[model samples]
Structure formats: C-alpha cells, structure tokens
Target: MSGEWLAEVVQTLQGLGLNYAFVLNPGERGAFIRGMGVTLQLCLLTVPCSLLAGVVLAALLTSGRPWLERPARALVEVTRNTPTLVQLYCAFLVVNMLITQRFQLHGQTNPLTPFVWVVVVVSLHKGVFHAEALRAGIEAVPRTTLEAARSLGFSRRQLLLQVELPLALRFALPSLVNNLVDLVKMTAVASAIAVGDVTYESIMIWSQRDNVLELLLLILLWFGLLTWGVSVLGRRLEAHLRMPGYGQ
Candidate 1:
C-alpha cells in the first residue's frame, strides 16, 4: 500500500473512533493476539509457581530453624526490596549469560529462554509478598486451635497441613488475591527483557503506527478485566471459606 493511502486509511479509522483499527488489521491483529497470549501464558505459569514458592518460603520462615529461616527471610527481603526490572536485567544479562557460556549447545536453544527468565524473576518478586501475606495468616491462627490440635495427637506436619494452612489460607485470601492481581499486571515488565508479552508487542506496533493512546487504552482495558476477575474470584473464595460466626 502507498504511504499516503495508508495514512488516509488510518486517519479515517481514527475519525470514526476506531482507534483500535490496528487490532482489526489482519497483520497487526496476529501480533497483538500473540502478545496477549504470551501475557496470559506468563500469568498462568507465574501464579501457580509463585504461590507454591510463597507457601514454601513462608513455611521455612516459620520453621524455627535458623539455617533455613534466615536464608528464606533474606531471599524474601532482597527480592521484595529490589526493583523487578533490575532483577530481570540481572537474570537475563548476567545469570543467563553465564549459563549460555558454561554449556555450549550448538544449534540448540538455551533451556532458560526469555520466557523462563521472566517467569522465574516475576515469580520470586511476587512470591515475597505472597510469603509475607501467608506468614501473617499463619500467625493469625488461634493459639487455642493449635493447642487443641496438639492435644489430639496431631503431629507437627499434620497440624500445619490440616489445621494451620487451611485456616491461614482463608485468613490470607484477600491479600493473596491482591498480590495475584498485581502479579498479573507486573507481567508487563517482561517486555523489558524482550519476552514479547502484550506490552512489548504494543510498543512495536505503536512505533510504526503512532497510535500509542489507542493501543494503551486497549492494554489498560485488557488488564482491568483480568485484575477485576481476580478480585471477584477472591471475594467468592473469601465468602466460601469464611469461618462460621467469623467476620469475612
């Protein structure tokens, strides 16, 4: 297509308030959709991994063993304190570079692709928040309840797995949901390391088309729906898991 004609078409689309025309263009649409897919995949993978890591970290922090507890606490502190972008940079540029050099794989891609790096960094970053939230929940469990479980011959593992974790999860549900919502939004940072998530794709699109506002609006709407859905789910879980005669 001629440059003038392309410009006219884009202008017409914008005039009609179809600022999102790029999303409808077959060529551009594919890129946008692919980016959206990557973002979703990152979220799907990060959520579960981060949650599991958070639980483990929280367990270790409360384990009463100085060796395990100190290291876990330090990890949580460092990750939570540092900027996520810096962490991603270090992971991609430093850590991945070392791995690439140490193991020469001709014609084979590195096992830790950009996708894996993003997942690892984002998970650990948010895992700290999850750990903190869960730690509070664990502490919130009534001492009386723990004593009763102990009196009933519950082993430490049994008490934690059956009694403490369940109740703590219920207590922590709201904060956990908030952290998850933030985690979904934080996936946008993956674009920094060239992970090709929605934010990255949008940047590439707007650079050529100059439709920054329109594309950003779409990004905002997409993330809004995602975070809102998470909030709704959290509320439902909170309601369902609420203890009888206890405030939700």
Candidate 2:
C-alpha cells in the first residue's frame, strides 16, 4: 500500500482513539519496521533450529549410554528449570562476556550477534520440552509394535529411526505444537537484549509518543497474527500426519 493511503487509514484509526504513532512518523516507522524484521527472523530461524535440537537431544536422552544421557539430561534440567530471561542474560551477559575476554587476547571479535544469542538460547530452552514430550511418546508406544520391530531383527538404532520415532512423532505432535507456539512468544525476550524486535520497537515508539494504549493494541495484534499462524501450521501438520485407528 502507498504511504498516503496508509496515512489516511491511520488518521481514521486515530479518530477512534488508537494512535499508531509510527504511521506518519518516519523515524519511528523505520525503527518499528526493523524491529518487525528481527522478530520475523527470530521466528524463522529459531523454530526450525529448536526442532532439530529437540530431535538430537531426544536421541541423546534415549541412547542408553550414561555419557550421552547424563549431559543431555543435565541440559534439559537446567534449561527447563530456569526462566527464559535469565537464560538470555547468562547467554549474552555471561557467556558472551567470557567469549569476548577469551578472544580479546587474539584480537578476534565476538562471532555472534544479539540475534544469534537469542536464537541459540531460545532453541535450547524449547528443545528440552520437545525432547521430553517425544520421550514420553516413545515410552507410550505399544508393546506389540516393539515386538514386531524386534521380530524383524531391527537393531536399537534402526528400530528408533524406522519404527519408533515416526509413531512417537505422531503421538507427540500436539505437545510439540504447543512448545513451538510458546517458542514464538519466547522470541520476545530478544527485546531485552536490544535486538530491536517488535516488542522493543513498540516500546521505543510508545515511550516517545506517550501512546502506550495505542502501541499495546498494535503489539497484541501483531503477535496474535504470528502465534495464530504457528497454530494453523501446527494443525495442518497434525492432520496431514495423522495416523488412522490411533488416537481416534
């Protein structure tokens, strides 16, 4: 849409007591747009990474070896037990501090941006929940299914990959979706680190304009759209991957 037409719509909304401060203000508009870009980037990058991490972590947890299982279990316990904000602080303030100090002697710069920190931290946090959910699903698989796989001479790894994981995924889909939805919300914590996400942008604009109500409404609408999109995508996946005569 053209700027003028958008401005007209903004004017109309203003009459209804919703002042979208960024519509006519170019500077605030630019900052808010940048924030939106970061938010979208977080959603796109973190969700897939978390899923991959979850799969790997779940495999580690069920690998039947103390060496792998112990570390993975510790990771899950630490991540799941802590607040996301604290995790972000530890990742950015603490870990990044050490990285910077370590690299300073070599004249090397820190490799990651605030954006990457948020992505890694959030992915690990949500990944643990996904791992747990999948673990439960794996345990819930019927005895007959395990027997059939064993009867076919399936090795432990082969059985997990070929037979168990597929069914476990179906069983865990709902919980995974819920985790992902929360993952999207967790991306908001990026704002705390000055990543310029939508929430951060909204704060900037509203603080300058003293229009908290207006900005909050828009923020809610924006996040509502994002979370709704995740939900719809999850529902479609559940339907497409649904197993007949199971969980009916």
Best by TM-score: 2
TM-score of each: 0.91, 0.95
lDDT of 2 by residue, 88-145 (tens): 9988999999999999889999888898999999999999999999988888889899
Best by lDDT: 2
Over 4 Å off, model 2: none
Show model 1 residue runs off by greater than 4 Å: 1-13, 16-18, 105-109
lDDT of 1 by residue, 1-248 (tens): 56567668778877977676575477787898899999999999999999999899988887878999999999998999899999999999999998887667555557889999999999999998998998999999999999999999999789878988898898888889999999999999999988888999999999988889888988998899888888898898888888897782
Backbone clashes in each candidate structure, one number apiece?
Answer: 0, 0
- The CA lDDT of each predicted structure is 0.89, 0.90
lDDT of 2 at 160: 90
TM-score of 1: 0.91
- Provide the lDDT at 105 for model 2: 83
Clashes of 2: 0
Q: Give all candidate RMSDs, comma-separated.
A: 3.8, 1.5
State the weakest 10-residue window (summed lDDT) of model 2: 18-27
